[model samples]
Target: MSLARIYRGGLPSSKFIDVALGQGARLLIRRSSDRGIRGLMGRQSERRWIRMGHNLIQAGKAKRGRGMHTSGETDMQGKAKRGRGWAIALSVLAAAAVLGFGGYHLWLHRDVRVYVNGVPVDIRYRSSFGEICDEAGVVPEAGDLYSIAGNLIATGGGGPFTVSLDGVELSEAQLDAVEVEGGESFTVRDGDDAVEDSEVVERITAPRLVPAERLAAVTYVSQWGANGIDRVRVGAVSGEEILEEVVQEPRDCVLASVNPVPSDGRRLVCLTFDDGPSPYTAQVLQILEEKGACATFFVLGSNVGPWSDAIQGLEAAGCEVMSHTMNHRNHYATTSDETYRETADAFAALRDCAGVYTSVIRPPYGNWNEHCWISSRGTMSASVIWNVDSRDWELPGADAIVENCTSGIENGDIILLHDGGGDRSQDIEALPRIIDILREQGFELVTLSELMDADDRIPDEAARQYAPMPEDCAWPAQIAE
Candidate 1:
């Protein structure tokens, strides 16, 4: 059969054909039988007669036909070749279908969507409910349930809310909620004049008590004897009953010992430095040591390893070495467990390097929240915060540092200063003068733990008072020492 006369469909399904044509006045015909000519002519009778008369120079069939000749075996080979091509295409398509299905399944099941307060969140990865909530800016609530498509993913229970999700329950402290209450109508005072006749007063309270019990409890009992004085007893109680009576003494002020109220005696200041072990820290320590003053150094774990000698010197000089976390990351912006792990790692590193077990922690960037408490619960540490901040990190001059620090000196104040981070040259430069000024102003520089010793630094009580505040007021504006 001629190349033009070849029909692919009539070939056996298993055969594949390979055809090549050249530019020449020649024709080759191939068929399976002597009657092949009749079959080919019958299929296209009009074309067959014209083709045969036009190409009559070469008319014999051979194994390799080049001219007008007919061969049956060559026609069969072409049909088989065409069939094989179809089989190969089908095989390739089958492989592609398998890969496509596999990729689709991987994409569909790779990530999960998280929701907060009925709003869908783009988590895009498998992570704990606490992590998702942090990303969504949803402060976890005690007893709050986290679910995905009606299936519980985590449960909270302790800090402020108990979350339930995927059969796991995690307790987190809830954020403060704004509550509006009816009160006596008041007028707005603008420059001593009432601008509006009536003003609605709004009060914001912290979220309902976390599932965890208060760190301390208080009760008032009246004494009927000689002085007719009423005595207030503050106790550390468990959910079931009182664990220990904290203070049984009589006080003139009922709110006096209820909170960690600093005494109005001679000014007692706790100096706390974070991110330490820099070269400037040694100078700061030298000043503190010369003044016989002890301060709390919240050193980063990574800095400790490289500055072991410096850390040892600080400790030897009577400075308290505490944990500032393994990495100075924002605690409030991280997961509960991750925060816990970082804090734990810092503590572990301190213990390994400094041979000290410190229970004081200053969260990085001073970023703390209910989650920090939850993360630090049972970690044998108290969150130490500053009542006065010198803002030494601002690169203010030594005179400014002295002025800022001395400006807020008060009895039982915790002053925050930085010794690590970047250029603390200002801090080092200001330390001696600041110490002398504080002493001149009747302020005693002591470590945070020592300052807390004036009034017991109970973990629960400290946790409640150390709760997160707004970013604007996150760090105290002034320092006492």
Candidate 2:
């Protein structure tokens, strides 16, 4: 701390501090206040800052280090310089720490914390409860209990088949409905409820057509009615309408198949014969060939032995062959294993005899369940149903069958008939006449495959396979009905 040594470098106190800290060698080159380089942000305020930095550095160093005692005056000067330098260093360090702490909070600790199913997880922003659940991979399964915010959505799957969303059950929509802030915590329950208590919000009505006398070629959907589908949780429900001893809800009661089955944009009608390939199989093909038309035969597996060639000929003559099961038994009365064999055996026969496999299986009596679909998973694509029922099996005679078929034949109509069972001679007698009537009306007879693409299958309207509202469900009315 000698006066002679202090004046040795002729460097200002601030520059001396910078040198000592290795600023030129880039050691502590972070701060701008001492350098006279970052001129106080867009102005020459660095001139005043430099003067202040020199004074501060000198005093800071004096307070922290031994001063030169070469003389009384020199010792005092050295002390002042040391004190100033120490104060400047301390101030810079404190400012840096505060800035760094603030930066850390802004960058890393911004996410909202939420507990889903009792596990802590963070979401980086304000999110609704539903979005968080999805993020947490806890989507609601049908029958799983649900709650929105703090409101419980009550479903009656009860005890064994229940799921408890411990507390907050914010489905996606519900989450969107609320303002969930970041850093807030909410509890989501077990989320494994078996009976879903979802509100049946809309009613999608059956589609129908109206014949416009004035307009012969074009048609339009007459009444745009809404259908009401309720999400019901039932382990095994059996009633006249829906006799399914089942699980899971049907996507929609086949009350409405694809809005327009023949989405192919063609003027086509499907001539489908179920329980067929009978003694008069040749005659049906003859009529179809005569009219230059095609047809689909849903042949019973048992009948495949007697009428294998007719089945091949049906495919050969530009027709599609499908399944009618081994025996057309009531789907509800049969076991899952029984239904599996019924569908599998039919598929095997068609494949063995005709050298072709088809995915369409008209579940015996056009019935289905979660098990039916599960059993025939890969084998069946659709269960073909008829819009026009000939009911020729009722043996109501030729005229009645023809009347039933031709009365309401329109685009995408499936005309059901029998070619095999019983006196199919009635169907034989009615086939040519029906073909003639359809052609005279400017209809194009095509196979089920050609008439419409995809699993354009629907259940019988009489099947009435719909879930009853849960006895303990507290959902609002879907569509007044």
Candidate 3:
């Protein structure tokens, strides 16, 4: 390197070369003394390092090809200046970018004020209710009735919490995952003190059927069924529980079903008269005797004394006599006690007046109900109900009465006629014609007992036994007995 080029850059060429050589010798000496350098340069040649030192010397010398003030050297110096300017600009831009990003991030995550459990809380905007609660140090437990912004949220636990939001109760689904904005109020209270238990009426049980297997070929209801009642305590949490005492004890219907009627092909039909033993009783008896037919008379107990001769005549002529109650009251509307008394008196009267030991009674007006049936179970085997109506009480003329009696007369049917309720000249006139028409239709006119007796499958004792009334049936003790 020339001294002139070095002196132009303010350094002597010989000194610059001596400094380079001195630096190389110092580096080689340091490389040998330092263990890290020795390990790194163990395979490095000294000549190669010397060549690097020579290149450093060349870089220190200015490259002035034509003149000291040449355009090329000026251009090169200008380009180096521009490159440094660019590096400084790039450094300033990188620092500004970092500062801007940090500022934006700080602005984006702005703090928001929220009230949790009536305490003011400062947190980031759009924070969840759970996060707000956490920041406020308020932890909600089970059965806690808490509200957010006047909207209630209930937690499930051992109790039922009646929580409402803005005067409206919340459903079970809206109690979780609550999110809230800033400036909201919260409140909480224990539901146990606010809730009260309630009571409701409940049906205890339904009436059941009690069956009796051994009886005549008829169904008898010894006891009428009735439903029971009870009061139930309903808790807000526990639901329906703690049933109180039964309000009314349920009564089961005692249903005694006899063996099914046997189809013995005996075309027996019963002829029974209601409200009888009046003056028409003698006429009815004369008609039966003239037709050579036996019939049954449902004589009233009250009339049995005054009409004892007529009742005896009915009994002596092979006609069965049954009771029709003491007074002709509507058994359906009558109470059990009244029915029992009337039924007992009728039975006694029939037994005393005509020596008739029967177990049947025809309900007045043919309007019997379960009450009468249950009450009469003690005094009668079965209440005889008629299928064919003579319409004699209506006084629809004797021909019309005969038509009603014979139009649909089937085997094992009972024909109804009145002899004492009113004037029964029509019934007396229709009787002979009815007997003739029924006999012509191959139906043998018979009493109810006679028709029941034709079915030999029913035991004599069962037929004689009063309508299968169990001792335990739900009725008045006297009626049951």
Report the lDDT tens digits of candidate 2 across residue range 103-142. Answer: 5445443677666656776776556566777678875443
Candidate 3 residues 358-425, lDDT tens each? 66677787666545655664566566566677778788999999999899766677778888988888
Pull out the clashing pairs in model 3.
Answer: none
For model 2, the local distance difference test gives 0.57
lDDT for 95 in candidate 3 is 60
TM-score of the candidate numbered 3? 0.46
Clashes found in each candidate (C-alpha, N, C closer than 3 A): 44, 43, 0
Reference-based lDDT, each prediction: 0.53, 0.57, 0.64
lDDT of 1 by residue, 1-481 (tens): 3444443453322111122111111122232222433343233543433343233212212212542254677666754664565455445544543454445445534555554545666654434444555666765334423221222333441224334433344233321221112111111111211111222222221121132222211111111101112222222221122113222222211111122333435457777889987888878887887888888788998787888888888888887787788889887688877887887787778778867676557778767644465455345335555667798888889898888888956677677789989988888888888888888888777766555545543333333212222232111111112
Residue 356 in model 2: lDDT: 54
Ordered list by TM-score, greatest first: 3, 1, 2
Q: What TM-score would every model get versus the actual structure?
A: 0.43, 0.42, 0.46
**TM-score of predicted model 1?**
0.43
Candidate RMSDs in Å, in order, are: 31.0, 24.4, 21.4
Model 3 alpha-carbon miss at residue 403, Å: 0.8
Better of 1 and 3 by TM-score: 3
Candidates 1 and 2, the one with greater lDDT: 2
